[model samples]
Target: MNKSNFLIVALVVILGAVLSSVFIVDEREKVLVLRFGAVKSVKDEPGLAFKLPWPDTVVRYDDRILSLDVEPLEVTPLDDRRLVVDAFARYRISDVEQFREATGAGGEQAIAVASRRLDSILRSQTREVLGSVSSNDILSSDRAALMLRIRNGAIQNARAVGLEVIDVRLKRTDLPTDNLGATFERMRAEREREATDERARGNEAAQRVRAQADRTVVELTSEARREAEVVRGEADAERNAIFAESYGRDVEFFEFYRSLNAYRSALQAGNSSMVLSPDSDFFNYLKSSGGISAQ
Candidate 1:
């Protein structure tokens, strides 16, 4: 080859080698430098990273948390009730060296392999943990506690694949389609029975209140009437005593006052008139300005 051509070829080869030797590690990624398919160095921090060119290759795996959706699994709880559960897990690549060895794959392929392995672990653990509990526990407010147990179990198993399991959660747990109608009917019946009981209790309370109010009204009215009768009796006794005292003081004057009151009552302004003889005793006071003897 000519000197000029040889120089150009050397420059091209040098440029290629420099470009291949250096790579950037993003903040969200972890890198592995492999020599002949064996791990040589790990770059976990962001910035420039170097490796020998040609035979050496760089493989990157995401360092950020990742989510894996598990396939729906059917579990029979301790109550022997079957449920279809959908779950997911959060994980991150914690140990890249071990991950490489466990997955036996590089780059994005490692993530796929790791996911499959971790999925198996999560499924097995999920079934084992959930199977020991009752369906009520799985479906109630105790779900947070059950999820924690699931996460703990998954952690131990996921470590084998160099993944740190952050959490395991049940997205949904549902009765089988065949059981839905029956379950809903039972729930409706239970709610209606409870409502009936509440209404019965309310009616009983209202009756008690009404009866108490009625008794109170009767007692108050009777008490008020008794007090009024007592006052009237006292007034009658006082009036009779007063009449006796006035009769003892002056007999004629008492008779004259009583006759005057009689005249006022019998001659009140109304469509009422009395027919009497002119010599009647009632006219004695009118005949003479004095009394009956004077007439």
Candidate 2:
């Protein structure tokens, strides 16, 4: 052989030896080695490894967290409403053998297959299982529990297909396109109705309170009027009695006292200017009636 040909052969042998002896796995990955179309061994750790290159195939997969996003699906709610749900899942490969055997003996292809299965699982679960439960329960208390149950259920199904589901979670569940606007309108109407009812009740209570206060005021005013009437009647009766007693004591003096009192009260009440003859009847009381007076 020529020198150049000899060098080429040596290079080919060296390259083959290097290829046959070398295997590498990342820290976040695991691998399965297949020799002659049969799985020879599984590598769960990281770093360099040695294997026969010609007949052995190294299958690498992520050992760390893996995530899968599910496309949105249309769902019919218990209330007969349509909703679109989109979700995701985080998982890790639990068994290397099952993963290799079921998912085409490798991580990349195996995850793809597992994703399809997980999708089916999610769809079926949301429809048949989650649908039967109350919407309030799902929205309120059991959301986490529901997710966990779905995760466990997915894990169980994944195991059959050589996949291990670490977790499953819901990202969003929303009203479908046509129903979104209607749902918002209905929710707004319901809240507005509630607000209106609350306001009406508050107004009713305020009216009742005002009416009660008005009634109390009226009652107190009537009571005060009644008391005032009683006092006035008693005062009038006492004044009349006093006049009667004075009149009974001396008839002429009583008449003189009454006439003088009337004159004093009438004259002092307003501006008065009076001109009268002393001998007139208006001044008769002060006149001397020693002989006889006219009737």
Candidate 3:
């Protein structure tokens, strides 16, 4: 090779070596320098880092918050009710050396292993903390407190695996499929009983109102009948007194007036016929100008 060509190849080789030895650690990552498969140093802060070009490597781990969703599992609470629970966890790698030692793998593989470990820890802790509480408590507004306890427990247990459990949350808590039907039936029966009670109360109120109205009607009718009878009795007494006074004033005139009224009543009848002598008292008014001929 020519002199200039040889210098150009050597420069390229030197550039490759320099580039291979240099690595970058960003704000989102924690880098580990492993020499011969053993972690030699850890770079937690964001900056430029270096490692030997040959037989040395750099492994980057995401230092930011990570999320892992646990599959739905069944748990029995203190109330002895079976519930289906789904949980998720937020975590971050806290100790890089410990993390590397635990997984013995780098990059995505290590993250996957750590995630599996974290999921297991969270599931166990979830069961432990949730099982101590009643199902209603787990589903109540106080669930936030229960979640905090589970997170704390998970953090404690995960420390051995180099994970920092930031938070643990229950995504959903539901009754098991086998129990849902029975629960719905119980709810329906309870509602039906309440409805029945309301209807019975309404019917009772209606009956009371009807009975009171009937009683009021009977009382008003009875009172009206009594007043009518009193008025009728007073009218009869007044009529009898007037008749006696008229008789005392003129006995002959009263008899004549009564005889005229009787004759008029007998003659006014439709197609009426009477058999009587011409000189009979019944015809006195018709036979003479003055009834009874003033006898």
TM-score of every model?
0.61, 0.56, 0.61
Q: What is the full ranking by lDDT, best candidate first?
A: 1, 3, 2
Clashes (backbone N, CA, C under 3 Å), per candidate, total: 0, 1, 0
lDDT of 2 by residue, 101-216 (tens): 66664656766776787678767766664676655555554488878877877777777766667777777777777777897887798789999999999999999999999999
Candidates 2 and 3 compared: the better one by lDDT is 3
Worst 10 residues of 2 by lDDT: 286-295
Q: Which parts of model 1 have CA positions greater than 4 angstroms off?
A: 181-295
Candidate with the greatest lDDT versus the true structure = 1
lDDT of 3 at 285: 64
Name the lDDT of candidate 1.
0.89
| Model 1, span 61-99: residue lDDT tens | 989999999998889899777889999999998998888
Candidate 1 clash pair list: none
Query: For model 2, what is the alpha-carbon lDDT of residue 207?
Result: 100
Q: Write the per-residue lDDT of candidate 3 for residues 184-215, one digit (tens) a residue.
A: 78668878999999999999999999999999
